[model samples]
Each structure stands twice: as structure tokens, then as C-alpha cells.
Target: MNAKRKNKILTWIATISFGVISLIALFPIISLVISSLRPSSELMRQGISFSINFSQLSLDNYLYIFNQAPEYWAWYGNSLVISAITIVLSLFFSSMVGYALAVYDFKGKNFFFLLVLLILMVPFEILMLPLYQLMINTQLIDTYFAVVLPMVVAPVAVFFFRQYALGLPIQLMDAARIDGSTEYGIFFKIMLPLMGPSLAAMAILQGLGSWNNFLWPLLVLRSNDMFTLPIGLATLLTPYGNNYDVLIAGSVLTIIPIIILFVFFQRYFIAGLTTGGVKG
Candidate 1:
């Protein structure tokens, strides 16, 4: 075959392969959606199966979630507020730390970076007890601050931002400084706009982590009103009875925010990942 024809054939094959992989990846989500539409009794009797009982499927679960579940909305709000704050604070603090590490010279910089790396290597499970104790000492339990504080300086975010920032030209900052711009001014006005892609990428990641975070919130948040989505959903299951109807429906609704988030940031996601991977 000619080179052009060979390349075209390969492209077709790659497209088909990717389409299949995409469908396979979407199977669980598809199943969840279908399960959510099914009656709870049906789910209990049949479990999850390919068999579609369209006749029995209805909007009862969704209605119950929307109309009857006040706690669900409270939990949803808590998750939203916590994740929003976490995203903003994480981006602010992590980016600043990462930016400084990328561009500035200071004492203990290497040591601090090394500490971040070491912390990243350690599992959160190992630190949970101590972190819980610290929270108790500070009396931050059952508060949103307890959930938001621990993750605000995410090590992974710092590392990624640092890698992306290292590739940014320092000449701009020098020029800005010469023009009477303070360090904060240069960063906020110049460097931040340039770091859009990395910022978007980290925002999505950090938002997702905070939204779905169950363990830390579970440990800290004692009241029902303070519970996040994951913990609130968990409360539906008990030794006596399980509220599968609301659980499945709530789970389906939980996906909507994340989908909106990805849609908003998707334009920059790939670009940010590529720059961070290549430069960092």
C-alpha cells in the first residue's frame, strides 16, 4: 500500500479501538443510570442485570429524593460549599508555594520541597489518627474547616503547579519588577493568567477530591446537616433497612456537578496536563 493509504487505515483502526474503549469505560456509569431508574424492590429482587424492565421503571426514586429528602439537599449544599472553598484555597496556597519554589531562592526551600514529596509518599490512612487527634485538640471537628484545612496545601497540586511554572519565562517577572510591580502584583497580574491551563486542571482535581472526600469528613462532621454527599448517602444504609431508592438516585444526581465542572474546564485540561507532564 502507498504511505497515505497505510496511514489512513491506521487512523481508522485507532478510532475504532478508542471508541470501543470509551464504551467499555462508560459501562459502569450507564449501569448506574439504569439502576437508578429501576424500582428499589426490583433492584433488591433482581440485583444489577442487563435485563431492562422498562415497564416497571419510573421516576419515583427521583421524586422521593427531590420532594422528601431535606437532608439530601443539606448534604448536597455542604459538599458544594466545602468543595468550592477547598478548590479556591487549594489553588491559591498551592500555586503560591509552587510558584515561589519554581522562581525564588530562599533558605529551606529544598528542604520544604523534600518534605512535601515525603508527605506525598505517605498514605493518608497512616496520618488519619494523628490528624483526627489534632483536629480534636483544635476543636475543629464537626466543622467545615476540618474538612477544608487538611487538603488546602495539596502536595500533588503544589508539585504539578511547580512543574508547569518552571517553564514560564522569568524575564516577564523581572520586567514587571522594573516597572514598579510588587512580587504579588507580578504573580497576580502576569504569571497567574499564564498558568490558566494548570490552574483549571488542578481546580477540577481538587474539586473532585473535596467533593467525594468521605473519610475525613466522616471522622470530623458529626451532625447530619454538616455531612457531605458521600457521608449522607452512607447514612441511608443501616442495620435495619437500606434506602436503596434514594441512594441510587442521589448517586446519579451527584454526577451532574462533576460533569458540569469537566465541561467548563475541559478546554484547558489537556493543554495543562501536556505542559505539566513535559515541563514538570
Candidate 2:
């Protein structure tokens, strides 16, 4: 075959392969959506499945969540608000620390960066007890602060930002300094805009992590009204009974914010990941 024809054939093969893979990845989500439309008893009988009983499927679960499930809405709001704040703060603090580590030289800078790397090596579960103690000592238990504080400057975000910043042009910062800009001005006005892809990428990641975070919030939050979506959904199942009607439906709704977040940031995600991965 000619080169052009060979390349076209390869492209078709790749496209077909990826299309199949995409469908496979979407199977669980599809099953969850289908489960949400069916009765809780049906789910208990067969669990989540592709078998569509056309006559039995109905909108009662969706209707119940929308009209009757006040707790679901509260949990939804809690997740959204906490995720938003965590994303903003994580991007802000982590990016600054990462940028400084990548670009600047100062006393103990190496030590600080080393500490961040060490943090990455340690699991959060190991630190949970101390963190929980700290929270209690600070009187932040049962508050949003307890959930938001731990992840505000996530080590992974800082590391990713640092890696991406290594690929940025340092001469730009030098020029800004020469033009009489302050350090903060150089970061906020110049460097930050250039780091758009990294910011967008981290926002989605951090937002997703914060939204799905269950253990930490479950540990700190005392009130039903303060529970996030994951914890709230967990409550739907108990030793006595399972509220699968609301569980499946509420779980389906939980996906909406994540889908919206990805849709908003997906354009920059690959670019951010590519540059971050390949750089120092």
C-alpha cells in the first residue's frame, strides 16, 4: 500500500479500537443510569444489569429524589460548595508553592520541596489520626473547615504544578521584574494566565477528589445536614433496610457536577498532563 493509504488504514483501526474501549468504560455508568430508572426491588433481585424490563421501568426514583429527598439536596449542596472551595484554594496555594519551587532559589527551598515530595510518599490514612486530632484541638470538627483544610494544598497538585512550571519560560518572570513588577504581580498577572492548562487540569482533579471524599468528611461531620453526597448516600443502607430507591437515583445525580467540571476543563486537561508529565 502507498504511505497515504497505510496511514489512513491505521487511523481507522485506532479509531475503532478507541470507540470500543470508550463503550466499555461507559458500561458501568450506563448500568447505573438504567438502575436509577428501575424499582429498588428490581435492583435487589438482579442488581445492576443491562436487562431492561420495558414494562417495569419507571421515573419514580427520579421523581422521589427531586420532590421528596430534601436530605439529598442538602448533601448535594454540601459537596458542591466544599469541592469548589477546595479546588480554588488547592490551585492557589499549591501553584504558588510549586512555581516558587520550580523557579526561585531561596534558603530552605530545597528542604521545603523535599518535604512536599516526602508528603507525596506518605499515605493520607497514616496522617488521618494526627490531622483529626489537630482538627479537634482547633475546634473545627463538625464544620466545613475540617473537610476543606486538609486538601487545600494537596501534595499531588503542588507536585504537578511544580512539574508543569519547570516547562514555563523563566525569562518572562525576569522581564516582569525588570519592568518593576512585584513578585505577587508577576505571579498573578503574568505567570498565572500562562499556567491556564495546569490550573484547569488541577481544578478538575481536585474538585473530583474533594467531591468524592468520604472518609475524612465522615470522620469530622456530626450532623446529617452537614454530610456530603458520599456519606449521605452511605446512610441510605443500614443494618435494617436499604433505601435503594433514593440511593441509585441520588448516585446518578452525583455524577452531574463531575460531568460539568470535566466538560469545562477537558480542553486543557491533555495539554496540562502532557507538559506536566514530560517536564522535570
Candidate 3:
């Protein structure tokens, strides 16, 4: 085939492939929203069908969820708190570490960067036992601090920020130093403003990770009051069967903040990913 003909064929194939994948990913979310809107009676009648009766749409499930399941609200609040704190702490610490790695000249700097990569290779499951034991010794179990303190520093965020920072011009830092700007001033006044995209991306990633975290929270938090959104939603399933409407509603609610964050910061989020990949 000619080059143009082959290119056309490849483009058509790629477009069709993407369309199929998009529909596959979209179907579940569409089904969840449809199910959440339908009344329980209609849902039962449908028997796994995606169809919903528009006339039977009601907010009772969501209202009942809030009124009956007070623990759900507690879990929601705990998740928000933990995610917010984790994002702030992670951004601060990661930026500092990444800046050091990107700018400073010192012995063992490459070794330290390798160590960050090494830590990322170690899965969280491997550290859980020792982490649990440490939490127990520190009497941190069943407390908010137990969840927030452990995740304040994230290797992935550090790696991302460092790569992004590497793309910055060293001339700017030298100029700032020549102008008598302190190291802290150069970071806060110069580097940080330039790092907005990467920071937004890191914040979104860290927030989602912290909010959806179940295993660590399950290990540390035993009380209903201490549960995060995922753990609380999991409790909605009983031995009999799951309440499909309520479960869907809870799941929808859990994803709202993430969707909102992406909607508002999507441009920066995309730029950050593209820049990081290029620099790396």
C-alpha cells in the first residue's frame, strides 16, 4: 500500500479502537447513574436490565442513606479530612525533596534519587505488617493521625515534581541568587509559581489515592466512626445481598469530588502529565 493509504488505515483503526474502549468504560458509570435514579421497586423488577422508569425516579434512596446511615456521613467527613491533609503535606514535602534533587549538587544525590525509585518499587502490601505494628506501638490505631501521618510523603509525587522541575531553567535560580534572593524566596516566589501544573496533578493523584484507600484504613480503624468512604460503602453489602440503589448512590457520591477537581483543573492536569513525561 502507499504511505498515505497505510496512514489512513491506521488512523481509522485507532479511532474505532478508542470508541469501543470509551463505550466500555462509560457503560458502568451510565448504568450506575440510571440505577441510582430508579426506585427500588423498579430496580427489582428490571432484574439486571439497564432500563429505568423515568416516572419512578426519586431522591428517597439518597435521603434515606443520609438519615439512616449516620456513619456514612462520618466516613465521608473522615475521608475529606484525610485527603485534604495528605494532599497539602505531600505537596509541601515532595516539592522540597524534588527541588533538592533537581537543583542541588552534592555527593550521593544520584543514590538518593535511586532510593526514591527503589521505594516506589516496593508495594504497599509489603509494608503493611510493619506499619500496622508501628501504629500499634505508637497508639495511633483508631485515630485520624494514623492515616494522615503515614502518607504525608509520597515517592511518586516526588519523582513527578523532580522531573517537572528539571525542565525549569537554571538561569532563573542563578539570577534570583545573584539578586540576593534567599533559597526559600527563590522556591516560593519563583519555582512554585512555575510549578502550578505539576502541583495540581500531584494534588489530584494524592487526593484520590488517600480518599479511596481501604486496606490501610481497615487495618488501623476499627470503629464505625473512624471509617473512610470506601470502608463505609463496603459495609452496605450484607450476607443477604447488596442494596443496589443505595450502593450505586454511595459510589456516585464518592466520585463527585474527583470529577469536580478534574473538571476545574483539567488543563493544568493534562499539561502536567505531558510536561513530566517529556522531561523524564
Residue-pair clashes per prediction, in order, are 0, 0, 0
Best TM-score among the predictions, by candidate number: 1
Which residue runs of candidate 1 sit more than 4 Å off their true CA positions? 1-21, 239-241, 267-280
lDDT of 3 by residue, 1-280 (tens): 6999999999999999999999989888777776777776566656547555678778887987777867678888999999999999999999889888998899999999999889877899999999999999999899989988768878888898888888888899999999999999999899988988789888877887798888999899889898898887888765444565567677888877677877898886565445436435
Clashing pairs in 2: none
lDDT of each: 0.88, 0.86, 0.83
lDDT of 2 at 97: 94
lDDT of 2 by residue, 26-137 (tens): 9899888888889988787787776779798899999998999899999999988999899888999999999999989899988998998888778889889999999999
TM-score of each: 0.87, 0.86, 0.85
Q: State, as a TM-score between 0 and 1, how close model 3 is to the true structure.
A: 0.85
lDDT of 2 at 190: 89
Q: Name model 3 segments beyond 4 Å from true.
A: 1-21, 41-47, 242-245, 268-280
Model 1 poorest 10 in a row by lDDT: 271-280
User: Which prediction has more favorable lDDT, 1 or 2?
Assistant: 1
